[model samples]
Target: MKKLLLIGFMLFQYMSFAQEHAWVYLTDKENVATSIANPISILTQNAIERKATHSIPIDERDVPVNENYISQLKVQTGITVMAKSKWFNAVYVIGLETDNISVLADLDFVASIDFADKSLNSESRVALSNNKFEIEESLIDFEYGSALNQVEMIGVDHLHVSDYTGEGIVIAVLDAGFPNVNTMDAFQRLRDNDDLLGGYDFVDRNDDVFEFTGNEHGTRVLSDMAGFIQDEFVGTAPDASYYLFRTEDSAGEMPVEESYWVEAAERADSLGVHIINSSLGYRVFENENYSYTPSDMDGNTAFITKGANIANEKGILVVNSAGNSGGNEWQIVGAPADASGVFSIGAVDFEGNYAPFSSQGNASQPTQKPDVVARGAAAAVVNSSNVIINNSGTSFSSPIMAGAIASLWQALPDATNEEIKQFVRMSASQFNTPDFFLGFGIPNFELALEIGLSLAEEEFVRFKVFPNPVSNILNIQIPTSAEPTNLKIYNVLGKLVLEKNIIQSETKLDLSLMASGVYMMSFESNKGSKTFKLIKS
Candidate 1:
């Protein structure tokens, strides 16, 4: 009996150390029905699971399986596998027979299945509590040519939609109470775009996804990123969709908050969400020893950090705030952003300068975080009165950037999340050189759109290439329908060195004599001048 208890304890410990949350991809390549039953229990030895897209959905509630119901499901749809405990209905069951996807899709009772992990891989950073402030003037809009911040907003009216927006993409934004979101006029565009989807509240552990309460900060963040665009402040992804999840309870910070985020992410994954955005992070608490040191930032110390990484592996894009209090003294950007796989966004002023309050990143930790910067400095967001208020924080910057990224994603649906991240990073204000303050700097969606690499369905200039990677000869393939065209080629440097004009069929350029380096070949046509990255080797 003692030996039995010891064995049970050992098994328990091992299970405890396993990944906090996980999901399996349901694919067409594998069958899910074969299971071996021992005298004690059903054992899964080897029947071929784990292939990409070879995943199955189970009830997250973990209610006792109705043998009758299971038999009926097998008869109705061909799903023969029973779910395992632990994850309940929250996780995708890996071995469901591949035949039920169509039938399951037809069932309105079934909500959604796992998409991909968009969680950030970074670990949580140590917290620095200083210089935190509230929104100013609630929410407001400046004149078309106002003395206010025009540097960042310059020419925003003509800014084209050409990047990923989570349009039709459902994201579960787990944070504190998003107070007064419905009352804000700035979020009206989200309503108009139908980007605002339904959500659940795990903070109160119920379903008041948009509760009206203290610290309207959370609501402002959501509005800046996913709120509909109006005459007030325009979010990055005005047309992208969202699922506002409330995981952070009001008033105080609790360790249980971490567990709540995990559950929320798991639910988000099950709901076929494309991304999960959490602006709330943890490091310190009223209980001082609960405070974390830099070493704990490996992503292993916190439950939420593990969930953050798991969400990424599943293919959902997770974006986190780098945190405030840069002016005082913080070690690096806080966790899950500090964890390895996530994108941490810092704040920069409208003048293209790093905000003094924005956090910094150390070269160490799970990863060098605060991967990029956005106009987090004194930016405009919608307030409770449906007014536009100017707010500032890495928080505000993150959502604004997220909105733009969502639009970019919308524009380029085919872009891998990592590719989208890289594209944004490469096209940032400071891609060539980065610093602790701004990282890769703010991204230029105009540039991203001009490249026309995104999956955007909108009409934009598309790059046409003929005989790509031409050795001695480069051809500018032209369509007869296109207007007259002008072409230019440049090395990595912005300096222009080659120019051409297309009169008829196609224009040819000689590159065999050119030095070896990545170059950009661009064409100015009727739609617009589009650019593409050229590889020489």
Candidate 2:
């Protein structure tokens, strides 16, 4: 009788203290049309210009979250607002696992509830953790020194030689604490140039990002892109401007960090950031019940992944690190990396070999992940102490690749974000044959530049190909020309599969007889020869 009484008492106590983490989705915004009418009020002038250049519409997603709804939730008992996202029109809230919080669902403006702990609600959980960024461990006119291998591996050196070093480009680095970036000698150049545009600590809700006492993961990640130390070192995009944002809480592994990331990304978009490099990934968490399975790696799932796609749609190039779980149980790329719009990056050694620790992509997913590879094994980086060190993980590779992309974008300023991604993918070494490990393999920036320049020409711009990665029929919209054009399709092994003569502006090729694989379609004429990557589904 005493044992039963003790058990009943313990159950009551457990229920009293249990806290829940969830996202409280709002029904509608109070003023979407008003905000869209005056975009400059919410977004920076530079951001407005970027959207104009890309022809992206300023829709309701660009509107800020309604403050009144947040105010109402803030006044409620047993509820604490954590973060809010303008893209999803939702607010992250933490509260006691009791009737008070659950009553939020009954509110008229509340759309629904998504609990981080699946047991609290009917929905399954997504991934959240910082274990991936833990690593064992640049520049221009520039001795790359220890950073030479990584920069040259992706042909960033060639872009630097052409004087395309990310000048006028803005990048936002989102990760954990950036302890000494404000004082690091390696970043002194960035500070002196005044390229260090301010940032915010979303985790602590402060303006300071370099004052934390946790891990220096952000410092290391930033060094790969913005660090400069004269002849001793030069980051890939030393000339590029930066905004340092701390979104990860290294002290604890919680699902709220994902909401923190979305908030940061929304801020980045408003600031007109041209590129966003996230050297962090999510998978397992402290509470196994909040973990996501391998199948959940689909791009359409995960709150952060959805936010990433929205970031891409807003014309910001989102670059993320493929997690370091290749040899572990969670071997697939995690969360935002699985996001189709995200350019997920993987790790390679100095010799251009795949790093065993680099995360692989899901075979079932149609979109190839880890879009490309770079030197991550023994990659050179600057730490919080302002010292160069060797580290291994996709964490390092992502920044290396992102910095190169910034430089590439600088060279091709007029190119759209989608065009830039296609240029990089087409220039990859394994564009004709990608796998789960390296995706399209290491890219060649020099080759990508060449392709971009060629395609940018007025005559070449008229050449359009529809439905890339087709199943049965491929359509080509040939540019009008007096000279007769010839077409050739080749397999991965460089063996010719089909040849045809073009007689009109539009032509269709029946590929149903061909086996499923990647192909290179070449259009040759008196003007020149242009090749495009083709995939068979």
Candidate 3:
């Protein structure tokens, strides 16, 4: 009996030191009213301004997690507080999966507990997965050098020529590490301009993102956006400001990194970051118990995906890399990239052909997984040693696309996040017929700008059109005091299909004979000309 008792004691000790991870969700903040009333105390001035511009309300989620509850949890035996997320009203804790973590649920203030290890929990919970930082280095013009194809592919070169190079936009880069950005000559211009704002290392919980030399994935990723060498290499958004955060642990893959990522994202949102470019994708972890099934990639299942959607709700454009898992067993895009609000980017060759190595979208998803593609194969980027090199992956493609988006957003600063996404999607090569491989294919920023301008003009037009997808008849409502209006309809090929002149307040046009496709209608009068996009069904 004593031998059996000793064996039982040993097993208990083993379980105690397992060092399992879990999130302890709290019941309430207790200071929600006060924090919501004074958002400035919690959020930065820029963040408050962004919310006001987007009309997002300051709620309890904006309130910081109650420190008292955290302090209470810290005193518990065999438990260590790792990270706190106000957005989820929870704190990530590390302890024994059985006793220490489960005991937390007994506390009145503790609402529930979720274990990272799915089998450990009595209740069902999501198991997160993460991709290791990997890249395919391949061995890119004059002013743009080798970067010309990437820049011009998405029609951002025209915006650059017009001096709209992401001057006032702010982008946050969350990745593994930035080794030599502080000392690299390729980033000297960025430093001289003081556009490198700030950053944090959530893995080590420090601000020394460039202090480590273990992984340089982030260095290459940032080079696609902020790196500028006079007339040698230019990033997509050379003039944009940046905040670099190291959220991925280069030494290992763990679910804890997802919590770290959420912490970094919260900080980015507080700083009023306009865009988030995460070249890192998560789908599988070092521990098989935490691996995610393909069905879990439904945009809301993964923890990171949930946080990403919340980030979007806060009015930030989140861009992620569609994982490099193509032609493999797990071929679909990973979490956060699977998020509906995230602009997941895929890779394409210089010839506008889809890169087979780029991950594809799953048809079972609620929305398209990869919203667009950019040049990733043989893409030009600056390494940590200040050397311009070619790298291939959706990693490079995402930053390349993100930098261009910053420039596009700079041009239409008043446009909402949804509006910006709409314009870009509408300008893609395969907008009308997207496929699983390349989703919407590629976008043309030049055409996107034209679309935005045209829609802005339509807002002031005196005519109103209804039944946008009209089958047989189209109705146009003109002001009672309007002059004679001339209407012209054009097909997708820019060829005139129909034309008419109308003086009535309400005019109906017959279109039963028109082919079923997309068309544009233009109205001309003494005041000005207005254009409306129409779909003939």
Candidate 4:
């Protein structure tokens, strides 16, 4: 009796601190208009017929609601499912134990599920290997490709790649199976740069994710992050390090696969990985009954997603694919990718226009999904076999952005994840006014890094705005040695809140009637125009 009581007490403590998770809803098959445009719809209806849709919580607000759905959802699946989100055509759910999700699949109504475990498989992707360097050299078509040689070849206007590469940062790529990675010439760069950190094959539970054919997912992704650049195609972060972990199996999308992902994430975290780039997402699976509802978009649903969120909290920046099939029945984005802390990258063309195939979202429940966009259309990357192939999907876009993010982290070591995220969002081409299609818009890598560093430096300056979260009287205590050139403030709506030119040592402004929220302040010192985030209480 005493032992049982202690165990129960421990369970209670865990429940108290543990985060909530649920399966949530995406879209009902009944609601989907058609899928000739969306061949994926067949998968959804299959799930619905299998009671997979019923396995997901029913729409509480629907005309003929399944009154037993909510209670049964909690009792049967042991998770919470909230209301549906029209913006993303999904529902929100919250739960505790993210692992051992097989119990859900065993349920009569359930089809597929995700682990709710918060453990992450995150770690540094920087491991020096002869093979990694070789891939880098071979991809660039260089007799010998050094970091410097690759940099000189890329054709971007102003890429801050050197500062990042010189620092030697690592980025982990989590995706489907990678075939023939060992023999791939494209991987020589990863080997040469000493950036190919080891990874796990969660798909097959083996060390190799490339044992299968037709799955170049991992190979293409890793190449984008640390691929060697020649004339026409250049990766965003060619000099950075890389780690490859395969979480998806070639068979199809499923809950077991996500369990594998969670396990992988935990391993990554244990290795001290700095960043995780996951290009896999799930809405509908082979077991249609397990298709995700919008409510399941919360970070707490799948263990892998929970792990992804934890990765961010631990200072590891997490990036995920927004999902393809934009012009489909399940028009919203998919799970684990929808986790709040993770920065989901959407697909865009070279022109930075939103790709129609890019998944749409205001997130499943709330907050922004696909926090930013990157070039995904016709993304060029070297396959393991030394062949150059251009692929299209949010999957490719995610890794491209991940490379850029790794570069930024190398440049700004002291910066926090929030600082990095906000800086990237604010410096984007379409910032302030975000939408379902494009959250904050496309990030400018160089500009974002500059903004982040400037803010960190400025924070140390005498610019102390006392009573932050203030109702009025915003005071700026300027640094004695700094010269004030032009100061501007933009409201959350991107409206110019206030602007002034001052050469004085101190600055003060009054905001008696502005609605309270978050604001952006740009202070132009002779040095540079620095941007900072302000929250109004």
Candidate 5:
């Protein structure tokens, strides 16, 4: 009986050590001498340039975690460091026994330790399979034959024709795995031009992303943005530089992937990636206890969602896929998709109809989700074998939209990321009346360009009209280079009250004869036309 009791105790101790995946939160970066005021010491030159261009200030969160703390923890026996997050000031470690946790917590620099997984060996939660629709491949032509339809559907072809094919933009794609991206002919131009900057596989904690034997979901998703095959196909942003990050583990669904995603995002930000395209969403997990119900779809509830928001705050545009759970019993968009400031994309057919499998937004959230829809249903993509094929999912749509956004930014380099998002939303077909399924509807890149150009003109011209409530004369001041070619004043009833042709920098309008109310003064020039509200007394 005594021998049996000792054996049972030993087995219990072993079991306790077996389930030891926890996060060690460091108290501070004390050992590191780098100060947050000097971001150049931590961030790359490109990252500094990006922040300067966007007027984003460097904060303490941008600094790397204390290397001394990490090294000390690594030296401890029976502990294996998994991943590190500078944003959270924490490191995920496994194999930490109860005694080690107590001792580590007692360290001066150790703030806290939380078990990532409280229970193990729970019932396996079923993974949600992607609802992909297979379609026959179309005949490839010499001029974006199959790919043209997708780009033209969202009016991105206009930007491409205008020489804004996302040149000088850097985008980071985070997904399951990119199997044959290194050898795929469709990505040859990206490789040849050195646009494929770098990549890392967070799951294995290595940089060998191309050598993975996981799903080809990332390959197909990337083809929507970077793939090019002469005239046969042209991606949305073929000239944009890319960073590929493998953050998803195809074999399992767990919260640890979220931590991996945060780590990859921090890396992307450090590398100065302008945009991040994430085709993965989380709601269900391998452990049922870790699975999130629809109520947790609130943007702030999930760990990944919080990280995505922080990435946006760092001046990086995040585009995510609205999960394809429309027909499932738990039908709703997943966590990161509901994240605020994220450009969530939904799936739609070529006919501009919502795809049945496209997840809907949570009704409880005030903000309409799925900022826009794109040609995700039967979307064209290049597989790992370098063959063009058709598949269906929002995974294809998010990148499609992200590439277009990159092109838009390329065209309007002076525009802020927030302004670009606003323009895209305003240019959508249903901006005034958005719904949960396809919020604001499909975006028209052509319209967005017009708006951007108009805004630019306003900034450049700096034209102003003053003397609102003027009893006699109203003065108009125009920039010397942009003298008004014509001017017109209209009443609220759309009746033209006055018209004149001006070739001078200053024009005086006699408003004494006009009745007191709201009127509009129109100014037309070679650059563009603008209208301003005039208040008369």
Candidate 6:
């Protein structure tokens, strides 16, 4: 009887301390003196460069949260700060039982106080396990070893042969944690060449992401893109640079992780990342009331989805994993995947059939989700121990598709993110008849490049140049149907080297004086103008 009484007392104590988390929304950035006029003061130089290239403006959203307001909130003894979102103009905090959170609503800076966790019941706060999906390892023999099937399935090798290996692209990977990426032999090339730019641990509020002892899910996801072992395994975008961020906490499931993801994405945008690959998704939360239903899967709903859309507007191609809930009762693609602008990926087998575990798109949503499918079942990956292995999940598929997209973007550096996405969709096998399981089917990089080139030709006047690597003379050929136009040749730096009038369909120019390098040729006809890359040998 005494033991039962003690148990009851402990339960009561537990309930007393389990107060709900809340977000204090500030009315405005009033107290903050930071100005939006000078984005360089807040954003990095790379970030500035991206904005300049993409013609994206430095707006009010780019400014940091008011430090004075946050500092004042920190002074409160009973509140523990969780995360701050500059995008939402809000700060998430956890209050103790003795704290009077209602008093915060009276503060001049405070807009409103809302509970982060809607459900306060202890039983509804149980953490969800991460072992819902099982990985199946398969052994395959090919010239490229473990990576051969996956890369070849998507035709990324063709881009590699054309020397489009995502050399200058920057990709930011947001995941649970990278356990052994720093020391793994498979990533030796990336480390030696400084391709691994840097990373941060948002959960711990530290910069030591490499040393963090967390799950290997991130390591596996990264392996599909950057891992390389000479003649053993070659990732899709082996030359692309990367920023690793730990946004998800593997030990627990909660809405706070969504805030962490948004924070990481904002950091990525500020770092001028060209692409973001997020394999994490949110659906069920520890607090049942915070969980999303199928109807909430609409693109505009969840916080992460909204954040992803904002990231897309900033010119970063966001690739996310369609949740792996197909076999379960709540079988539908989760949050950010439902977000319109994101390039969500699904899982497929080697035979081009949808993986049973791959989640389908939300039927109610108008947009066909899981933008495309990749070889996720028994997908090749290098483990944390530097050994090549096979794993299965949309997580692996998302990175595989992301790397290929990067390589494709490298081939068409002048194309906008939307153009690239459209070309990729057009190159899919089932583009015209997209289904829920595999939206546009598998994408072919070779075909995507061809489609992009064709679209460019249509947008601009079509012309041909010969003896591209010419040593003495270069030949220009305009279609007989085309009108005579002025032809100009510029160096890679956009400096005009020569200009001539093309009166006839066939024209020749002496180039013996030019040095050996790459150049751009532009033909300005009455109809339109076109520019093509030229090689001078």
Question: For residues 1-537, could you state the per-residue lDDT of candidate 4 as single tens digits?
Answer: 999999998886567436343333322333333432342333333323322211322222112223344455656444555332221223234455444233554544443442322222221112111100001122334233322222232222245534565135657677776777666666566577676667777655567655764466687777777676465345667777666787776654445555556555545544556678888886554433344555566657555566576556545678888887566655666667677778887887666678888878753444676688877766666676766665677877787777777777778766655566777777777775778787778777667776776666544454676677778887776666357567777754344667788777766677777678767778777675557766676
Error of 6 at 243 (Å): 0.4
* The 10-residue segment with the lowest total lDDT in model 4: 127-136
* Residue 116 CA displacement from its true place in model 1, Å: 29
Rank the models by lDDT, top first. 2, 3, 6, 5, 4, 1
What RMSD does model 3 have? 7.6
Cα lDDT tens digits, model 1, 62-106, are 122234433433455434232321222222321233334334545
Worst 10 residues of 2 by lDDT: 135-144
Residue 75's lDDT within candidate 4 is 68
Q: After superposition, which runs of candidate 4 have C-alpha atoms over 4 Å from their true positions? A: 1-157, 229-233, 298-300, 458-474, 477-520, 523-529, 533-537
User: lDDT per residue, candidate 6, 405-441, as tens digits?
Assistant: 9999998887766667766776788865778899888
- After superposition on all C-alphas, the RMSD of every candidate to the true structure, in Å, is 13.6, 6.7, 7.6, 17.5, 9.4, 10.6
Report the C-alpha displacement of residue 158, candidate 2, in angstroms.
0.8
lDDT of 3 at 259: 84
Off by over 4 Å in 1: 1-166, 192-194, 228-230, 451-537
Of 5 and 6, which scores higher on TM-score? 6
Q: Give the TM-scores of the predictions, in the order they appear.
A: 0.61, 0.86, 0.84, 0.63, 0.79, 0.80
- Each prediction's whole-model lDDT (CA): 0.57, 0.85, 0.84, 0.60, 0.80, 0.80
Per-residue lDDT tens digits for candidate 3, residues 1-537, read 999999998886566446678889999987789878888989999999988988888888888898999999999988989888889999999884458888998899999898877777643434343444457774422334868889989999999998989999999999999998999998898898899998999888888999774789999999999988887789999999999999988877767788888888899889989999999877766655665777888998878999998998898999999988876777898888999889899999999998988888997776876889999888899988778889989999999989999999999888767667767776789875788788888999998888777865635457788787899988888886359888878654334679888889898888999999767677888877776677899
- Our model 6 lands, by Cα RMSD against the true structure, at 10.6
Could you tell me the TM-score of candidate 6?
Answer: 0.80
Model 6, global lDDT: 0.80
Off by over 4 Å in 3: 1-17, 122-130, 139-144, 458-463, 466-537
